[model samples]
Target chain A: DAGVTQSPTHLIKTRGQQVTLRCSPKSGHDTVSWYQQALGQGPQFIFQYYEEEERQRGNFPDRFSGHQFPNYSSELNVNALLLGDSALYLCASSPGGWNEKLFFGSGTQLSVL
Target chain B: DQQVKQNSPSLSVQEGRISILNCDYTNSMFDYFLWYKKYPAEGPTFLISISSIKDKNEDGRFTVFLNKSAKHLSLHIVPSQPGDSAVYFCAATYNTDKLIFGTGTRLQVFP
Candidate 1:
């Protein structure tokens, strides 16, 4: 009955540093997706992972990368973080494809200084 | 290129009134549209969705109307309650695994 769980509710990082955000999908869910939401903006899709492989990606740059493990857990990594990288990183879980209703985690607030 | 646009940044309505939130998209290929309700610190919750095949879908007091020709969609909430006040996000997908979201509209239902 537990929903998606995220680690390190809030984080602070300096410029040029690499940061990793973790997510554990809800029970019985197998797909994981990553999204970035800047202040006053809606969540933007970064990538989606299914069957332990990336199935689709958005218009994000190379610096933003993700990995899906066998357990349906996922991680989002951002390298050379810039000040603009400070935003809320959200992880969503679905039962199957993109069309399914996505259940989201509270999100990890990343602050890049 | 912002494919999805919610021109109104915010909307306010009185209790027991009807509140409508509008959304438009430029991509004609998008066939699936959805709405999400979000609080200040919480992640968005799925409100409702409509596929290309349907022009309208209703669930309780919330309804979604899709005008395919105009590439526009709207969410209507009746007898608005204060608890319904939150940021509403419009999202679209083209039968793919990715969704394009709009800037979102903040709705405030007053007493």
Candidate 2:
């Protein structure tokens, strides 16, 4: 089966510009989660989407938001981007029950200039 | 503050030797712990995991040991190979919430 897939593998934008990254979860997963991986740091949770609604969110600011389609694809939107926003954006999906492991996409590399 | 910490930023070992990576967490509520390995330009790949109910879990040549009382966990890779060299991260979760990850440790296995 095809694993989680993310589009626009790499992106570059100027500060104050908005960016949208897309993700298609694994074949059978229903829950989608987003994470930010800064240089030298591990991935940090941004938020999770289940049933088209944001179920849990991390300490990120309001500038970060996301949407999940009925087909289980997801989009992460970052408004008023800053230089610090330049990082790898990862999209992960789980089976949506008591499953603990997550299938992750290669991630979208966002570069803010 | 970081709830999970991997003090060692890098580790090097000869091939066919054991590689031990350590991780510590400050959150006592964390019950599920996992290890992930990542190559450049790739997302973290799940390696192994352990729950609070068990102190050890093994899968093939990879093993994870959890010390709940000390809030520490470790990953052991036996007879390490050069291809095993990569950045390893430790993560934990409470219930079904978001996973908190450590900084990561880069392991280099030399032949």
Candidate 3:
């Protein structure tokens, strides 16, 4: 069975531009979550989508938004990207809603130059 | 404000030695804690976890200890091997859906 898969292994974007990263969860998994890992830091939770709806969110601003499709895949969109937006965007999938072990994808490296 | 904190940025240990990475959180409501390991250019992988009900949980050479009173948790790797070297992150969840992570601790095991 394949693990979580993310698109565009690496990307480069300029300031004021918007970017969308995609994720397909692991087989038999239904929940999807997004995280941001800055250089030399741990992954920070962005939001979680379950049952095709956002179930929980972190302290991120409105510019960071996400959507979950019926098939349990997810997309993370960052608008008006800034230089600080450069980081590794990771997608994780789990079978249940809460306290479930997560399977993570290699992540998409976003570079705002 | 950083709720979860891993003071030590990096740790180095000789092979077959014990390595202990510490983490502390200011949030008392957090009841579930977990540790994840990450290699370069890879996503963080779940290592182990402990609920507030248990003070310790162990899996092979990996163990996680939770001290609720002190709001601290630790991951202990016994007989550390070179392959075990990676960045370790401490995460906590209050309601179990969203997790808050601390700055990771990079572990280097010398052969």
Candidate 4:
């Protein structure tokens, strides 16, 4: 069984630009959650998607949004990137319904210059 | 406000010794806690978890202990090995989907 997979292992964007990161969940999983890990910090919750709908969100602003497709894949979009946006964006998936353990992808390293 | 805190930025232990990593959370509402291990360039991998109802949970060489009164949790690795060296994060949730993670502690087991 393939684990969670993310696209564009690395990305570069300038201020005021936008970027999209993609994620494919593990087989048999239905929920996808996004997280941001800044340097010397733990992964911070961004939002979670379930059944093509957002189930919950964290303290992130409106500039950060996500979409979950029927296939269980997800996309995280960040608009008007700032220098602080530079971090490792991680995607994790679970089997849904109060499942606590999450399988995570290697993550995409985003650098806003 | 940082809800979850891992005060130790790094830890070092000799091989075969016990390694203890501590975490504390400010939210008393959190009922579930988990630990994850991450290597460089990789996402954090689930390690073990403990619920508020239980004080301790063990899985093979890894174990998790939670103290509800102190709002603190810890992860213990017995007979630590070099491969076990990685960044460890403790997270908690209040019966909700979103998890509040600590800053993480880098553990190195030297031979």
Listed models, DockQ each: 0.72, 0.71, 0.72, 0.74
Candidate number achieving the greatest DockQ relative to the actual structure:
4
DockQ of 3: 0.72
Model 3 CA lDDT for position A35: 92
Give lDDT tens digits, candidate 2, residues A53-83: 8989999999999999999899999999999
Q: Model 1's lDDT to the true fold?
A: 0.93
Compared with the true structure, what per-residue lDDT tens digits does model 4 show for residues B1-111? 999999999999999999999999999999899999999888889999998999999999999999889999999999899999999999998866588899999999999
Model 1: clashing residue pairs?
none
lDDT of 4 by residue, A6-35 (tens): 998999999999999999999999999999
TM-score of chain B of 1: 0.98
Query: Which 10-residue span in candidate 2 chain A carries the lowest summed lDDT?
Result: A95-104
Off by over 4 Å in 3: none
Candidate 2 displacement at residue B105 in angstroms: 0.4
Please list the residue runs of candidate 2 whose C-alpha ends up more than 4 Å from where it truly belongs after superposition. Answer: A97-99
**Which digits, one per residue and each the tens of the lDDT, describe model 2 over residues B1-111?**
999999999999999999999999999999899999999878888999999999999998899999989999999999899999999999999986789999999999999
* Model 2, docking class: medium
* RMSD to truth, every model: 1.0, 0.9, 1.1, 0.9
Please state the CAPRI-style docking class of candidate 1.
medium
